[model samples]
Target: MSDITLPSTPNKLSRYEITGYILIAAGAIVLFWGIIMFDLVTLIATGANEEVGIVFGEFGEFIGGIVGSLWALAGVFLFFATLTYQKREFELQRIELHKTQKIFQQQNFSTLYISFLNKHNDIINSLTAYDINKSEWSGTNFFVFFQEKVLSSFTQKVRTKEESAKTPELLHSFFKDYFIYHFSFYQTSLNPYLKNLSVLIKLIQRYRAETQDAGEYYSFITKAGFTQSELFLIYHVARYQLLVEFHNIDHAFDVFEDLKDELKVDRIVQQELNDENYL
Candidate 1:
């Protein structure tokens, strides 16, 4: 094999690199100054006639030089160690990114499903500030009121899942009913991100079909205090609402129509993966 030589131009320096260099330079200067001081003390001590003066001067210089040299060494070590750790972390992150990309290519359903989960969580987190800032509601119901009310219910569902989840079946039922009622009236309730929300729901439904291990699905649902069916429904509804808030209708709906062809998997593989972890 031929030698693999690297390119000359490197990436830009980070703030951390700039700081580390500054620290190392300062430490080196201190060490150099300490060495010079120590040498001067040695020479002066040799010339001193009084033994006490020589002893005191030499002792002082010894302490200063030792401290400065240690500080310099520590700075150098820290700089090198930081670089090594950052490189390792970056490589690991890159690997994760590539793996995610591959998964998106091969199993687009799973990719869309994961994106929905993430977006749902993000929207839920964003509403906390709104709750804190708002006071009494006006006689007329506004968008904010509707958002807050829906958000409260959504938050409770999330907390329940985190605390004592049940089977997905029960949770799915509740969400199916709830969304059917709400979505019928407020078709525009999921105003902004409706398209993304719709896509996410379809993706989740696909995941349900792909997932085959009834026991494992039940286990996750039980952990969340919901039946396997119910949890899935609740999750989709929450995610749908969240996406409506975050995206426009066209974009959100577009996700459902993306027509990810690679998601078609063998029944055996799908069953095997269902028995595996949720990831």
Candidate 2:
């Protein structure tokens, strides 16, 4: 197998990368305004517009959201350029990846992996969810809804539970039961995507152990270009202990803030979950 070239620290800025930097500048400006704007913007009114006062009162939210969303877009722009560069850089490895086909399958494993990556959003597109008001959502809106309505609510639910009740065993069962009952279709659609992620990670580990060619093959797996919601879902999936094929997923998380917190379960509960006799 070829030494799969990882993304090096990019030296040249692409057009979008430049745009992203400009947006960073814009966001800094907006953030400054967000800090002082309630007083500054209102003071500019000079009681002339009076601005309904309530309208001016929302300067903070308006400005803050603009700044926050601005930064998110900037990051996306930068990430796109990085992905573009990495794609070109990894061309050799993709060809060499054909050698693994005998093990992964008889067909071209490189094309197979790329196809799986391409279909990720298609799976996300197939995922349907109803918001609190029964509004059907898919695609990007689906991720936002899941993060805001689903994960946020689940986080609060965990907070409400006693520490002793915070075990992976209980949480896993709870989420499985709840999601199966409510988001059964969503669950069904997401399995292939998640399974692919687990498979890709395991494949990288297998390649590493066998080849001993220390290259960043993991980035090939990370090329799925996870949306924030997708990342959160992966983290939660592992936390809930739902994925049996999943391995080496922890490395994909980039040491998320709640990485340890999610697994902080009661010792007795931990023992129980490990005991196959109880299962």
Q: Which candidate has the top score in lDDT?
A: 2
- Residue 87 lDDT, candidate 1, scale 0-100: 80
lDDT of 1 by residue, 1-279 (tens): 122233233466555566666666776676567557556556565655686466556656765566556566656666776876678677767767765765564477545556665674453333222234666433122334543344345335534663234434544444444445544545453332345444554554344444532232322321333222223333444445544333333232223233222211122123323434422
In model 2, which runs have C-alpha deviations exceeding 4 angstroms? 1-109, 155-185, 217-224, 251-279
Per-residue alpha-carbon lDDT of candidate 2 for residues 104-178, written as tens digits (9 for 90 to 100)? 642344565566666765766776778768898887667566655554444556567787667786655655544
What lDDT does each candidate get?
Answer: 0.45, 0.61
- Give candidate 1 misplaced runs (Cα > 4 Å): 1-13, 37-91, 94-279
